[model samples]
Target: MKAVVVEAFGPADQLAVVERPDPEPRHGQVVIAVEAAGVGLVDILQRRGEFGFSEPGFIPGVEVAGRVQKVGEGVDRGLIGQRVFAQGSGGYAEQFVADAAGLVALPDPLSARNAVALGVNALVAHFSLRRAQVRPGEHVLVRGASGGIGLLAVKMALQLGATVTAVTRSTAADRLAELGIQNIVRRDRETEPAGPFDAVIDPVGGAAVPALLGRLAPNGRYVLNGGAAGFPPPEFGMALVQTFFNSLTFSTFSLNSVPAGEAGAAARAIFADAVRGALVPVVGPVFRLTEAAKAHLALEGGDAFGKIVLEP
Candidate 1:
C-alpha cells in the first residue's frame, strides 16, 4: 500500500509518498480500503510537528471514507464490504484500521468522496451548536464563516431556524451569498452591525475573541473550536475572570476528544442531517493520494473556501 509518510516534520517537502504495509485490523477494529481522505488544518499542523500526536513516521489524516475489507476478532462479520466513514489516526493511506465503535455506515445517497468532505468539520459544527444550546429564532454569528467548519456552522445554525450572520473576508462575500447566507459581514468590519447576539461561534481566535465577547447578549454563549488565525498564547486568567463577571459562557471543543461510546451516535446523526440536505459538504478541491504535499500547500494558502479532499 502507498501512504504519505512523515519521517520528520518541518514543511510540506518532508512528506514522501512511499510504499508501506497495509494495516491489519486488531480486535474490535476494521481495516478500510481507503477511497477518500479529508484534508484539514490539523493534518497540516501534524505534518509540521505542531499537533504533538507522536514523534516520527506518522500518517496524519484523522477522517476517512472507505469500504470495509476485513473485520478483526470480536467484530461482526456482517460488516465486511460495508461502506463507512470513520475518524481515527493514520487515515492518509490506501488502507487503515478504525475502531468499530468509531465507524458510521454511509447512507446510500452520500458518495464516498462527499462523506470524507463532511469529515470532522460537520461533526464539530454539530457539537459546537449543541453545546452552545442555540435555539430557534436566535441570532447567531459565525466567525471564519467561509472556512470548512465555519461554513457548516452557518448552515446548521440556519437549519435550526437561527438568523445567521457569517463573517469572512470581503472576497468571499459572493460565495457566502451563493450559499444562501444573506447576512454576510467582512471580518475587517465585523463589529459594525453591533450585535447582542444570542450565540457566537468563533473558530478564529486571537484579538477576534474579545470582539466576539463584546457582541454577545447577556448570558449568551461563545464556543471556540479552532484558531485559524493562529492560537496566540491568550491571557486566559484575566479574560476568563471578565467572562465570569459578565454572566456569559465560554467553551472550547475538540471532536477528537469525543468519547467512543458517543462518537458513533453523534456521527450517525450528522450523516443523517447531510442525507436530508440540512447540512451540505462543501468540497473545495480533490487531489490524488500521492499529492499530499500539494494538498498541504493548498490548505496553507488560505484562499480555499471549502474542504479539500485526497482520493486514494
Candidate 2:
C-alpha cells in the first residue's frame, strides 16, 4: 500500500508518499480500500505541529470514503463489500483501517469522493448549528462561507429557515450565489456587514473576532468551529467584555465532543440528505493520493475553494 507519512512535523514538505505493507484489520475493524480522503485545516495544523499532540511518522487523515475490503473478528462478513464513509485515523493512504461499528453506509447514489467531502465537514456544521440553537426566521452570518464546512453551514442555516449572509472572498462569490446566497460580504472589504445577526457561524477565527462580535444582535449566539486564519487576537477577551450587555453567547465545538451514537445518527441523516440532493457537497481540487503534500499546501495557503479530496 502507498501511504503518506509525516517524517517530521514542520510544513507541508514534511508529508511524503512512500510504500508500506498492507495493513490487516484488527478486531472490530475493517480495512477500507480508500477511494477518497479529505484534507482539512485540522490536518494542516497537525502537520505544522500547531496542535502539539502529533509526532513524526504519523498518517494525517481522519475521514475517508471507500468500500470495505476485509473485516476482522466481531465484524459482519456482509460488510466486506459495503460502501461507506468513516471517521477514523490513517486515511491518507490507499487503504485505511477503521472500526466497523463507526462506519456509516453510503447511499448508492453518493460517490465515495463526495462522501469524503461531506462526512466530517457536514457533521461539524450540523452539530454547530444545533448547539447554537438556531431557529427559523432568524438571521445568521457565516464567515469563511465558501470553505468546506462553511458551505455546508450556509445550507444548514437555510434549511433551518434562517436568512443567511455569507462572508467570503470575491473569488467564491459566484459559487455562493449559486447556492442562492444574496447577502454576500467580501472578507477583503474594509467595511463589515450591517449585521445584528441572531447567530454567527465562524470557521476563520482571527482579528475579525471583535468586530464580528460587535455585529451580533442582543442575545445572539456565536459558534467558533475552526481557526484556519489562526486564533482570535488577544483583544477578543475585551471584545467579549464590550458585548457583555448584549447577553451574548460564544461557544467552541468539536465533533469529538459529541457522543458516538449521536454523531453516527447525524452522519447518517447527512448522507441521506446528500442522496436526496438537498445538500450538495462542493469538491474543490482533486489530487492523487501521492500528492498529499501539494494538497496540504493548497489547503494551508487558502487556495482551496471547496472541500479538497485526495483519491487513491
Candidate 3:
C-alpha cells in the first residue's frame, strides 16, 4: 500500500509518499480500500507539528470514503464490499483499518468525492448548530464563512430557517448570495449592521472574538470552533469570567473531542441531510494520493473555498 507518511513534523514539505504495509482488520475492526480522503487545516498543523494530539511518523487524515475489504471476527462479514465513509485519523493511504463502530454506509446517491466533503466539515457544522440550539427566524452570524466548516454552517443555519450573516475576506459574496445568504460582511468592515444576534458561529478567533461578542444578544450562545486567522488560543478562564459577567453562553467545540457514542449519531444525521439535498457538499480540488504534499500546501494557502480531497 502507498501512503502519505510524515517522517517528521516540520512543514508540508515534510510529507512523503512511499510504499507501506497494507493494514489488516483486527478484532472489532475493518480494513478499507480508501478511495478518497479530505484535507484541511488540521492536516497542515499536524504536518508542521503544531497539532497537540499525535506524534510524528503517523499517517495524517481524519475523514475518508472507501469500500470495506475485510471485517474482523465479531464484525459482520456482510460489510465487505460495502461503500462507506468514516471519520478518524490514518485515512491518507490506499488501505487503512478503522473501528467498525465509526463506519457509516454511504448513500447510493452520494459519490465518494461528495462523501469526503461531508465527512468532517459538514458533521462539525451539524454538531455545532445542534449545540447552539438555534431557533427559526433567529439571526446567526458565521465568521470565516467562506471556509470549509463556515460554508456548511451558513447552509445549515439557512436550512434551519435562521437568517444567516456570513463574514468573509474573500469576494465570493455572489456565491454565498446564491445560496440564500444575502447578509455578507467583508472582514475589513464587520461593524456595518450591528447584530444582537441569537447566535454567532466563529471559526476565526482573535480580535474577532470580542467583535462577535458585541453582536450577540443577551443569553446568546457563542460557539468557538476554529482559529483560521492564526490567533493564539484564548484564555478559557478569562473568557468564561467574561461570559458569566455578561450573562451569555460560551462553548468550544472540536469534532476530534466528541465522544465515540455521540459522534456516530451526529454523522448519520449529517449524511441524511446531505443525501436529502438539505446540505450541499462543496468540493474544492481533487489531488491524487501521491500529491499529499500539494494537498497540504493548498489547505494552508488559504485560497480554497471548500474541502480539498485526495483520491487514493
Q: Name the best candidate (by TM-score).
A: 2
Ordered from best to worst TM-score, the candidate numbers read: 2, 1, 3
> What are the TM-scores, per candidate, against the unseen true structure?
0.94, 0.97, 0.92
Winner of 2 and 3 under TM-score: 2
The sequence of per-residue lDDT tens digits that candidate 2 reaches over residues 1-312 is 999988898988889888899999989999999999999988887788887355788888999999999999999999988998998878899999998888899999999999988989999999999989999999999988889999999999999999999988888888789879888988776467878999999899988888888889999999999997889987786777887899989889888899878989999999899988899889999999989999988887776788999999
Candidate 2 TM-score over all chains jointly: 0.97
Better of 1 and 3 by lDDT: 1
Question: How well is each residue in 1-312 modelled by candidate 3, as lDDT tens digits?
Answer: 999889887878888888888777889999999999999878877787888556788899988898999999899999999999887788899987889988888888889999888778887887888889898999999987878899999998988999998987646666777777889997665554488789988777765576567667877898888876666345544554665656778788888788876877777777788888877888887899999988877777766777899998
Ranking by lDDT: 2, 1, 3
Tens digits of per-residue lDDT for model 1, 200-298: 887787765765676788888989899877763466435546767568888888886778667678778888878998778888889999998998888
Q: What's model 3's lDDT at 220?
A: 88
- Lowest summed lDDT over 10 consecutive residues: which window, candidate 3? 232-241
lDDT of 3 at 301: 72
In order, the Cα lDDT scores of the candidates are 0.85, 0.90, 0.83
Q: Which should have the higher TM-score, number 1 or number 3?
A: 1
- Model 1 CA deviation exceeding 4 Å by range: 188-193, 236-240, 243-245
- When 1 and 2 are scored with TM-score, the better candidate is 2
